[model samples]
Target: MTQTKKTAKILRCPSCGMLVQPKDEDFPFCSDRCRKIDLGKWAMGVYKISSPVLDPDVLEDLDGLRDGQSRDSDEQ
Candidate 1:
């Protein structure tokens, strides 16, 4: 018996929940625009992966040491 051709796999578009077939050049996205949109999403939250190593709050003490504090100041 012979079987009809079938797509290797089906993938959902990350941008817009559309079904896509493996043979598609943009396998995860139905169109190139959708793929670009997915990339943009990743670009936006890239900060989490590269947050500043030293927070400004940690350096606040340095400024205080340089400038004498006044009694009215909030320093403890």
Candidate 2:
């Protein structure tokens, strides 16, 4: 009988779609640069949740907050 060694798990980088190993410092991403780019996209609102708002009360609260902020800015 023969035994075979297992290979490390591989994943694609979210920013550049490059293959990465689980053992890497940036496990899922290819490098530090790619990781930072992904963060930048999130900070810049390039990515957003694709689901509808199920709670009407939460939506109303968010609208109220927006209105309050605009009024405060106008007063300033």
Candidate 3:
């Protein structure tokens, strides 16, 4: 006879760092309060998703695009 072992996955809440289960109502957050706290942080600009433009070509292209857009808007 052969036997197999089962392992359960573990997850932690992002806001409170509490252990959370996938089956929980909040899933990733420990509670509704914690979930709202995370949302508030995003709404208040406490969290930002940004990266510096490293390539000169990409920067020039972006500036050109912006200038074109502004000219188009002014023409309208």
Candidate 4:
């Protein structure tokens, strides 16, 4: 029988540093704790925000704000 090889295609769980097998759905995190930590990093904006064109309401609000702010800037 041919054995399946595990490779770096597998990631260790960050929290426990467990070998967290490649087949696990949450392969790299090993448990919920690591996932939550990763999520917290994102929540803290450790990464820059992308443009909000992804949200129609945000884009509309920004457009409205831009018009008002620019009108004031032009008047000055």
Candidate 5:
């Protein structure tokens, strides 16, 4: 006979840092309150997703746009 071990994967709630299981009603969040809190943070801009501009051509265009805007402001 062979014995097998089962491991339950646990996750922490994003809002409260409470240990939660994937089978929980909230799945990622511990409760509806915590889920709402996370949503509110997003709505209030407390959390932001940032990605680097990896394209060199796009960076050059952005720099040119800034320069043009500054020149226009200076002319006025």
Candidate 6:
């Protein structure tokens, strides 16, 4: 006979710091309320990307692409 153990990963709700499971309907959040709260923080600009883009060239390329796309659409 052999014995086996099961392990599951644990996560916390970003809004309330409540322990949550990946299998939960809300996954990272404990409930829809917490999920909406987290989204509201983002919508209100409370959360931000602290790190700059890794590639300066890629950023410039993206800006150029945006400008090109806008000009192409205007000409159409």
TM agreement with the true structure for every prediction: 0.46, 0.56, 0.63, 0.44, 0.67, 0.60
- Comparing 1 and 6 on lDDT, the stronger one: 6
Ranking by TM-score: 5, 3, 6, 2, 1, 4
lDDT of 4: 0.79
lDDT of 1 by residue, 1-76 (tens): 9999976655688789899886888876899999888788788974356665386776677666656565337576
State the lDDT of candidate 3 residue by residue for 2-74, as single tens digits: 9988888778999989999998998789999999999999999999999999899999999999999999999
Q: Scored by Cα lDDT, where does model 2 land?
A: 0.90
Q: How many backbone clashes does candidate 6 have?
A: 0
Q: Per-prediction count of colliding residue pairs? A: 0, 0, 0, 0, 0, 0
Higher-scoring candidate on TM-score, 1 or 2: 2
After superposition, candidate 5 runs with Cα above 4 Å error: 1-7, 50-52
On lDDT, the stronger of 1 and 4 is 4
Alpha-carbon lDDT of model 6:
0.90
The most accurate candidate by TM-score is: 5
RMSD, every candidate, angstroms? 10.3, 6.2, 5.1, 6.4, 3.5, 6.1
Model 6: per-residue lDDT, tens digit, 51-73? 87779899999999999999999
Per-residue lDDT of model 4, residues 1-76, tens digit only: 9999866755577666777876777766787778898788888997677764778888899999999999999999
Please list all clashing residue pairs in model 4, or write none if there are none: none
Better of 3 and 6 by TM-score: 3
Computed on alpha carbons, the lDDT of every model, listed in order, comes to 0.76, 0.90, 0.95, 0.79, 0.95, 0.90
